[model samples]
Target: MDSHKILSLLGLALRGNHLAVGEEPVEAAARAKDARLLLLASDAADNTRRRTVHFSEAGQCLWLRLPFTKAELGRAVGRTSAALVAVTDIGLANAVANRLAQLDEDQYGEAAERLALKAKRAAERQSELRAHEKNVRTGKYRPKPRRTPEDSSPQVEKSPPDRRPRNQNRSRPRRGSPTRSPHPYAHSRPVKKGKGSFRKRED
Candidate 1:
């Protein structure tokens, strides 16, 4: 159950085309009936682990968490990096699982416990907020009303139109059109000398 042996078996599985590497392939393999086991890296992202676990459980496949980092697992199978790998061959799956079980305690249990604790705290916070909302609705808690600046200021009552501007010289700039005086030549008809209004007098 040495780590080296486990890695060698994974490489063999990959070479024989019985291994599914990377996220999508692992998820697909887990969902397929032929998949026998899913191997997840210890440092695999929370989201990746969650997805693979969900799919594996749904497909009723076994999932084993390895102690290696993504790079180590990927390198074992000639990959750049990998979060998951699925074994499609039953014999290889059992061998890998048994090997893993022999050497170490549950490598994944601590992470799972942390996730569960976080979920519990979040649920408790949400429940408290819901209870507070229910109390507000039932009139058990009354929040104080906030006062705005306008509410606090006094009204001036608009003093008597400013007393007609004291001396009337500047009285609202005169509202109506003022009367226009007549033109100087308004009394006389236009001279009828010609249709043209003005012409030189005959000599």
Candidate 2:
């Protein structure tokens, strides 16, 4: 196996902040479902291996026993010693696994293939999300029509048409005639009943 190249890739991942070193961080990543792949040093203790297995199951990720020892893995990640590491990025995880698979097909081939498929799907989903967001910003997204209660309710029966003429129920004045005044004195005017004097007689 090209251990040097693997170590270089591990260092790159660390530098990119894609790696979670040590048990606590790895465990946190696994529990949060952020871990894509986990690497355990070949020299790790039995208990650590058991915990890595548990974490792999919890995170639904793959775990591999690296060919390098704890010290080598630690140096690659700038740590004193590291028995376990988690790769959170799918693309990086796939790259690292592919390299490992090239070195040892029996051990890493299946895992590399799985990570590749996962990375592809993740990329496709991200593209789809970006397209959807673009459509919304460009005013091309068509929202589904909303259904209201009135739409779903049964049609109401129409009221029967009036049998009488339209003007029969309404008292309307003739066009050129004036309407009756409500006030009794509205039409009262002074009259010259006694000669040149105009007087309003009391009714």
Candidate 3:
């Protein structure tokens, strides 16, 4: 039998607080229906074995006799001696039973298979719960309003900007420059006849 693996799992369960050692605690867990599996040491007393059966019935869970003695089981759970142990978590129960079934399929096969299915379903439920919580935290639980084609506003085509030459648009020159008349003769002064006139006036 793979005794080391079973003991290791027990130690893990103990560390996680999923295991209840001793008669009183096991019986309490069984009565509360929190025990997933009950483990009985191979060297347990007849009376202890009988009570384990009763506890299993009360908890509606499976009970298995481990190949390890009370001392070995006890050390696995950090106790001086332990004859009975109640596993509260389904996953741990499944792991321990699966390792046992690998050692002796004829004895632990059915329980392992049942616990495996239960653990799988429990894991799926936990995953779905986490996803739901994430959606709630990120505000994705509410449906967003979608805009349809009919609800969209019409697009207006914009006219292109003027690209014509800028000089063609200027009709006047800049300020501070001399002005020219339309005809040179229009603004010419008449020649005066008083002094040294070179030009004569017609009558």
CA lDDT, every model vs. true structure: 0.78, 0.93, 0.92
Candidate 2 per-residue lDDT, tens place, 136-155, comes to 99999979899999999999
Local error of candidate 3 at 50, Å?
A: 1.9
Cα lDDT for residue 197, candidate 1: 48
Per-residue lDDT of candidate 3, residues 1-203 (tens digit): 47898999999999999999999999999999999999999999999999999999998999999989999999999989999999999999999999999998999999999999989999999999999999989998976799998569797788999898899776576688777677879967786657664567789
- Identify the candidate with maximal TM-score: 2
TM-score of 1: 0.51
Off by over 4 Å in 2: 154-203
| Angstrom error at residue 6, model 1 | 0.2
Residue 132's lDDT within candidate 2 is 99
**45: Cα error in model 2, Å:** 0.7
Could you tell me every candidate's TM-score relative to the true structure? 0.51, 0.73, 0.66
Q: Which ten-residue region of model 1 has the weakest summed lDDT?
A: 108-117
